[model samples]
Target: MSARPSPIFRNVSSKVGIIAAFTALNLATDYMLTGLPNVKFMDAFYFIATFEFGLSVGLPVVCFTRTAYAIVNPLGAAPGFLIVFLVVGDSMYVLSGYLSRTFRLVEKESSAGDRVLSIGLIGLFSALGFDLITNFGTGLSMVGGSGLQSHLWGALVFGLITMNFPLPLGIVHEASDFLFFSTLVPSSLALLSRSGLITTGPLGRVIGKRGDNQN
Candidate 1:
């Protein structure tokens, strides 16, 4: 006669497995796409994990993936300060995912265009926040000394304006995130739903499967 647990809390070991799987996937994708400069799918995976499984699964995945990638990057390990910023910046996707789930931003009943728009907006804003925070952190790490405040502000501005310069790395980063979020994330969810794996969370509406069957 005990009350049933929420679906999110029902599968502890499976959820842990999911966390490890996502972290590994993020790291693999980051390494595979290292040459692309800012074009990584980490954000999309972070958002998808969070949106589907909630903060518990998302936080560990984000933390482990970002930390591992920063310390063992193909381009060389990031500095301690930069690594901290990278983790913090990437955590924004967790917040974005939580908000998206809470608000049911990408409901199963929504039209394809609407779903795309919702996920795209989330991706766009989350990417912007990630870029700003990490770029500022990059700037701060690059500058130091007497006029720290002024120098920090100047560096932040410089980082933003010239982030891509002749190459447009910044644009590639944001655009790729939007593309991945809108298409891949939802498609992944749908695939899971079709495979009968997604039976909970906001995505429960997918393929008309409800989370209500649980006792």
Candidate 2:
């Protein structure tokens, strides 16, 4: 019998490839969308993680992607703001991914009613959570004293608007996410079918069985 690949080896190779690809994709998209400050596409990566890879993968992926972006951008006049952005942004994405996964709201196979409820709740919670956490962090890191109040108000307004309306940047983020998942999920499902992990069937019927027992 041929020797099997060690689990550690297989896992390392698989994760390395996946993470590298994801990082490249994240960077490329950020670059392409840089001209349009009103539009951000990297949010799609987080959405994809939540939907496809589950919390464990999604959380780290979001955090790392945000950290990478911060490393590249180095935002704000103060270096401290840059540091806070990295930490706070990463934390927000991780929280969003974990919440989405825990709530089972981002599941691809959810019903319409479920979809509406899940997406609405998840969006509200995520937007608010990120806004609160990041605002506080930003205030602490960059601004001082009464700046916290201003930041809090800003977060609340930004969170409410972005979560509810189609702000230009938010639109781009959501559209990219929808497009990415629309393509990726079908391909994944197809691969699963071919690999015998899943099977297609008629409504209310199982595959591989020619049944006429509707009596």
Candidate 3:
């Protein structure tokens, strides 16, 4: 009889494959939402993964998916040069998760309402921060050929432009993000629990459910 594969190897293989599939899903979804600009489910997925799998696994999904989406240029080439800032900014979601775990901010007894707001706030800040940092990069890239002082001034000018007309969109994105995280995280935890993808014995300390938490 063939021996069962080593647990470590199986774990690593499954994680790699899952990340790859997530990357593809991100690419496809971004392509589909190409024109919507601020509407996206990406942050929802980020929150769910972080809540369920913890930082080591979840952060990679955030970075890998964003990197792959940027490379695919589903929207256009305009964001190509700004991908670095995006990777950095978007990783804030993962950082929030790390902070939550480190502080035990969402302990097992915490109410569903509390977790929802916590995750929603993380999503909100992440979206807003990503917009700022990415636009700052855009300004710098725009002035690549200019002198240092000129580049700084140019960056400020572009920043102003972004803050004026595009600022409201930031709030819109955050609203959508908050909604996504507040709802999806709990719903996903419910499903994951049911499928035995994670068990109370192992992941309980991190992600558990009373079902009503989502309601």
In order, what lDDT does every prediction score? 0.78, 0.48, 0.66
Cα deviation in Å at residue 164, candidate 3?
Answer: 4.9
**Per-residue C-alpha lDDT of model 1 across residues 1-215, encoded as one tens digit per residue:** 22222234444556777889999999999999998888888899999888777788888998899888888888898998888888888999999988777766567435889888789878988888888888888877666647867888877986797667777877888898889888888888777656765554552322123443322
Q: lDDT per residue, candidate 3, 1-215, as tens digits? A: 22211111125545566566656666677778878777778776665565556665667887888877777674555466678888877777777666555555555336878877877777788777777777678788765545788887788678547743745676677788888877876687678768744434332232222231311
Query: Candidate 2: deviation at residue 186, Å?
Result: 9.3
TM-score of 1: 0.84
| lDDT (10s digit) by residue, model 2, range 1-215 | 22211111123344445556666777778777766652444454554444434444555666666666666763423354555554565455445555554554356545755554445444444444554555444444433345667766665555545543554544444444444444543354346347532223443212222332322
Question: Which pairs of residues collide in candidate 2?
Answer: none
lDDT of 1 at 202: 58
RMSD in angstroms, all models?
Answer: 5.4, 11.1, 8.6
Cα deviation at 188, candidate 1, in Å, is 0.8
Worst 10 residues of 3 by lDDT: 1-10
Q: Per-prediction TM-score, please?
A: 0.84, 0.53, 0.75
Supply every candidate's count of residue pairs whose N, Cα or C atoms clash at under 3 angstroms: 0, 0, 0
Clashing pairs in 1: none
